[model samples]
Target: MRYALMTLIAVSLAGCTRAPAPVADVVAVVSASLPSDPADAAWNAAPEHVAKLLLQDLVEPRLQAVSTPDVRVRAFTAGQEIALRLEWPDATINDLPAAGRFNDACAVQVPLKPAAAVPDPQMGMAGNGVAISFWRADWQATVKGRGDTIREIYPNALIDHYPFDAPSLEKGSAAQQKMATEYAPAEGAGNRRGGARTTAVEDLIAEGPGTLHPAPAAISRGSGVRTPTGWAVVITRPLPDGLSPTSPSQIAFAVWEGSKQESGARKMRTGWIPISIREDQP
Candidate 1:
């Protein structure tokens, strides 16, 4: 059933022709951070794209209420790396789970090929693939405050004996992390037992719906923070080696607000937007 629904989504997104972003609206990425201190200056100073996203109910796994309506994107490029900062407003803060539910999230999607007709915005279509960098609010909370831990997520849960934290061992916190690696190497470097994760951001690629998978060790990284109004996220990647110097590339965006039960194919998303090198922009 899941596979069938995913196929439907890919076909639907493919049939819907998205308008290409105009040249005037192309985001200009600069050579360096505008301010000396990244924190001292508001990151919104960069070229902006205000996207009006729509609910993802056109396919399967639909949702309601939790859709974030507006997404503000600011972008900049410094030397080899390009960064995008995304912002959206939501009244409820949904970083933690209630019952068995999940937390809020967002992502930035860009096509792997530079000059081709942009891939289907709802993941991708057929052989054309899109690479995505995801940011989850729950992971951000874990990285901050007390660090990622199972106890943190499930406050009342009890543990008999955690192997990572043997009282007799002098290594203390580091011991458990090593034990975690030994136990679940796929879990990566971390002391927390399933609270959040080592990295709040994840890199994934999709050739079509239901085909989302880990990217090929690509160089992409990012971070995010939540506020009373909404979320602020930043994603960075190196400029592709063979990108055409004259043509504008494509990028897309999506948001998943967990508080309103947005998950899977349920969330708000946008189609392709144009992006170009700062030096080339007229």
Candidate 2:
């Protein structure tokens, strides 16, 4: 669901001054811009068929909601189990039970058991409607300098949210999968890349100690975890939409280990993306 613009900044450049930034500052900004090699300017530019490249520096992505196919969730729960067998539609994505999750939210739950008989046409049945793929990521940036502890917080911003992308079920188009075992398909293509590509930092943080100003390995001043490696810079002017760790666009994504896009996975073409996941669930 794309958000409505809050305000429009109409700036007419009557007079502009381009001052040279500090050498260190310039290097840092340039480094952030290049997730690949510093020499590669190809980062962030879209492919030929792609009209424009909406580059994004993703932080983390999580599944919010999913669309179920051929089931009426509300009707099923409300209806009494008359013990009559009814035919189920082709697919069902139940909201399984979650420990810390709110009860108000629908999740997959344990199947109601009785005599443990096979689902026969003579037994009662219910299902949720067309499934949904709620793919989302919270793109973020950190604020540094002054009293603004780079460890404390980011002075970054995020994009306008939009509706979940609904892929057509028309067969022979595209397929998406999740990292969890239960979500595996009977047959599919490609190895498990897992969700989206997340940024890496541990090594980059180590790289910082010998180069430029270095920060602590691990510092906890308040509620957030701060590792010094300069900033894991990701361009955020435009973010890839609709893809999650599950349904991420198959094009290209950058993975940041600790501070920079090094250490794990492939090097980013340029630009930061929220493709990878932190074990703590970013």
Candidate 3:
């Protein structure tokens, strides 16, 4: 009777034990061409993975609370190029840029090393760097034919004459160019922020926190659309060094809610999530 009771107790305890959380996989479907549009019908064939986000409270200027709880991610690959579509909920559309104001944005990060030796998802470590493909709603607006001029951003605000718009100077004259450069020093200095952007996505690299910078070459392209509920963005870039149909990899995500004053490190982020590529199909 004692042995039977002990066996019954052990079985009950085993049944009550909790199971480990299942790892989310972002499987990349093979396609003939990568889609640049976030809402392209081609994306429907790919499976969606919900990546739960966490507050970035590990460093200073951190996110104290969770603004975006999660993001829906989908991936597609064509030859050596890969594209990721990220969808998340945001009630408001915050695209205009101004002092004390930030734009809604999302970024995808992948390690530079092989999958066997993955780097820390917090932008990676000193030697183990990561490549980041960032998409901003404001940049998307510009690419979608929205003007970036001060007048466009603030129609009611009064403004004096701009030297670049002076009619007396020839359209391509050196004097006119010099005056334009003087008025827009950031654009004159080749800063990405002030110049006209051709795409919504920017390729960047980071070794760790506080080390993010533009990549030597911009090899990424993307687009973002404002849905009724929120934003859906598609970011495409050259496949990383070691990712293959059979070889799996990892990815991380970060989302900034402009309305919530989320910027820099003050945003919701995710740790490394497993990802795999699928074979090409007819």
Candidate 4:
């Protein structure tokens, strides 16, 4: 009976001391500067992590099927900032947005405040918020000198006379500008997506499912390029508030395949994954 009691206690202690599940961290190597180009050789120094993606079906407008199964991620840090390079297989390129046409895009999501417990990976919870740096292939094309004009987007498109282009209205005149604004209502309303963009990335914040909004300050930058077999992208942004060389944080990812009609909430996503920053090797 005594031996049985001892065995029971030992078994209980063994259960208590069992090792926790291994965590795969996206380790960020120290660098002098963050790379904005996806093809930069600096990314080679960083270790790659393959994150498995799951279809987003928790809410309405969910993705009914999986198109992108995973994403390959590498990261580096320049003290104040960090950059992540993501690569995924994609056979086609879709960078132009039109009626019934979507743009291929990817996003990185991190908690606004790092803590032991993270916010919901599906954006966030009520009070907890997540900062997202979104990169679109179309935006990258625009930043790389693709004109946003309708004529550029649709070279074969035919247009009738535009009121703003009327001969009577002087160029740059208030009346002409007003007429132009009337025609481009979205641009007139200060919608950034409707006008020419200097950067290929947008910083956004979200709380819960339908509370996404543009971040007050736009500080992130990114670049994307087409590879022979897929798309490679680099997203650089300020480091999260509590990330440090010895400390670890979490990150999540979402990908949209325009070819598969994926947009908005219809996409593939990953849960929060651990991230660690390490000192540069000598």
Candidate 5:
């Protein structure tokens, strides 16, 4: 059935000269920078080519585990090509087998909502050299099928690398950091709104043990990166049962440093989704 569905989609899409694509919702912290043309407009509206590129390059490979998809990706875009984000919802993990953390490790009861994950800058035949932030927080978790061999071999199991990134730092261990780096962004450090305009910002790529980060990212002081000061995310995990003042379900986020050992590094103060986030036809 899954193969047939993908086949059907491929055939259907193949027959079309032009297909609707995914659109990215651009939320500008500084107004007046938003794209104006229909061709350039961010989320809720975008060209088909953008969506097609994402499906071909990123989405498809990540979606092999999905048995059925309710929402189809529509488009993608960014002033800063460095960080490209694709928007869509995935609830399939809720259907995976669960046997309470042994071998047949089932996913947490929480369903995955519409979310985006960062595609590797190295994905293309030519790697895009820059730091790309896909799901700034919660959505960063890795998703995929464990396959029959792995599942059969380890029935009452904890699917290795099961929960992607946790909202709390304490929840993710050194092992998780090593595994999460498999999906973490390239260690470029700093958001490039475009080729130019490198706002001075303090950023860190936390990895394992002491503020786990991947590669060491160098930022010149006069380079003008946005200076978001003093943060040290130790790890990423979901909000503990009740901790955040804002919606407790929010994804943890940071551009600089990481959660620290000081206190509450493992807690989410708010939920992640915002009104400007995009939604596709489901």
Candidate 6:
């Protein structure tokens, strides 16, 4: 009995000595200067650190888990702006938008209030809403040309004459504006009041799972570049006022793989992750 007790104690001690898993450090390094447009070189020059994140499949509405499970994130801040760089491996680039087709996309979610309690990572909760800045591959195409135009997507197709493109400039503008509203209702009725614009990313705010609403694009902006193996995306916005250098904040992320036909409730996502703002480096 004495020997058995001694062995048990030794085993317990061994178990206690096991080291915990290493925690990933994610910080938004402060910079004296940051470019308005984040090019590859700009991100490379900025002091950055990466965090490894694992995303679980959200299978409530449907089974949508085609995206890669691994995600890497880096970030930096300069002046009043903060930029987050997210990269993940994807075997294919799915930007084509057609019947039953979807686009590859990624999003970054941040709480509206700097110190607010963590809301639902899916979006947010009631008054604890989070700002979601979503970047889609299909949308990026529009930034370069008239992506929605039939001629742009389908060059081989024969000439298409629309009644809207009449000889009269005023009449043509009006017709096009009217068509824009019918095509994109989410853009609201205000788009008709002005000339059309090529929208890039989607800016939204959600209080809960189904409370997502379009937010002003002026709040957040993002850009992305596709690589051979995957995608590298940058999401940038002005820092929230009253945020202190050492204040601890939280950010969450989600990804959609169009090649896997992932959409809606079906995707891979991570819960809120703690982040801090570091003092600016000279």
Model 2 TM: 0.14
Candidate 3 residue 80 Cα shift, in angstroms, is 0.3
lDDT of 5: 0.25
lDDT per residue for candidate 2 within 1-282, as digits (tens), equals 123232222232334333232121001111112232211223212111111112122222311222111111100000111000011121222111123211011111111222233111111134211111111111111111123122223345343431222243323333422322234343234322222223211111111111211123311110111124211122221112322223322112222222121221211222111121111110
Error of 4 at 191 (Å): 1.9
Instruction: In model 6, state the lDDT of residue 135.
Output: 82
lDDT of 6 by residue, 1-282 (tens): 999999999999987634223236456778776544534665554444344444443335754333567567767788778888778888887876777878888888888775435777777888888888888877776665534665555678786565445455355476676764565665555532112335556778888876777785657777777777788888887775434476767778888888888766666777877767778532
Give RMSD to native, each candidate: 13.5, 27.5, 10.1, 12.1, 20.7, 10.9
For model 5, how does the per-residue alpha-carbon lDDT over 205-234 read when each residue is reduced to its tens digit? Answer: 332113323224432111110113211111
For candidate 3, lDDT tens digit of each residue in 1-282?
Answer: 999999999999887634222235888878888988887877767778889999987789888878999999888899999999899999988888888888999999999778467888888878999999988888888887887678767889787887687889998789997888888878777776844578888889998999998899998898888888899999899888788888888889999999998988998999999888977421
Point out the higher-scoring one by lDDT: 1 or 5. Answer: 1
What overall lDDT goes with each candidate model?
0.69, 0.19, 0.85, 0.87, 0.25, 0.68
Kindly report the root-mean-square deviation of model 1 from the true structure over all alpha carbons: 13.5
Higher-TM-score candidate of 3 and 4: 4
Give the lowest summed-lDDT range of ten residues in model 4: 16-25
Compared with the true structure, model 6 gives a TM-score of 0.76
The sequence of per-residue lDDT tens digits that candidate 1 reaches over residues 1-282 is: 999999999999998755324333437556555332223244544655788787775566766654688688776677767777777987777777557676788888888675447778888877788888877777777666655556666888788876666776556467656675676665664333245455677778898878888777747666776655777777777664334336568778888877678876888998877677665322
Candidate ranking under lDDT, highest first, comes to 4, 3, 1, 6, 5, 2
What is the Å distance of residue 35 in model 3 from its true position? 2.2
**What are the models' TM-scores?**
0.74, 0.14, 0.87, 0.88, 0.22, 0.76
Candidate 1 vs candidate 6: the TM-score winner is 6
Clashes of 2: 52
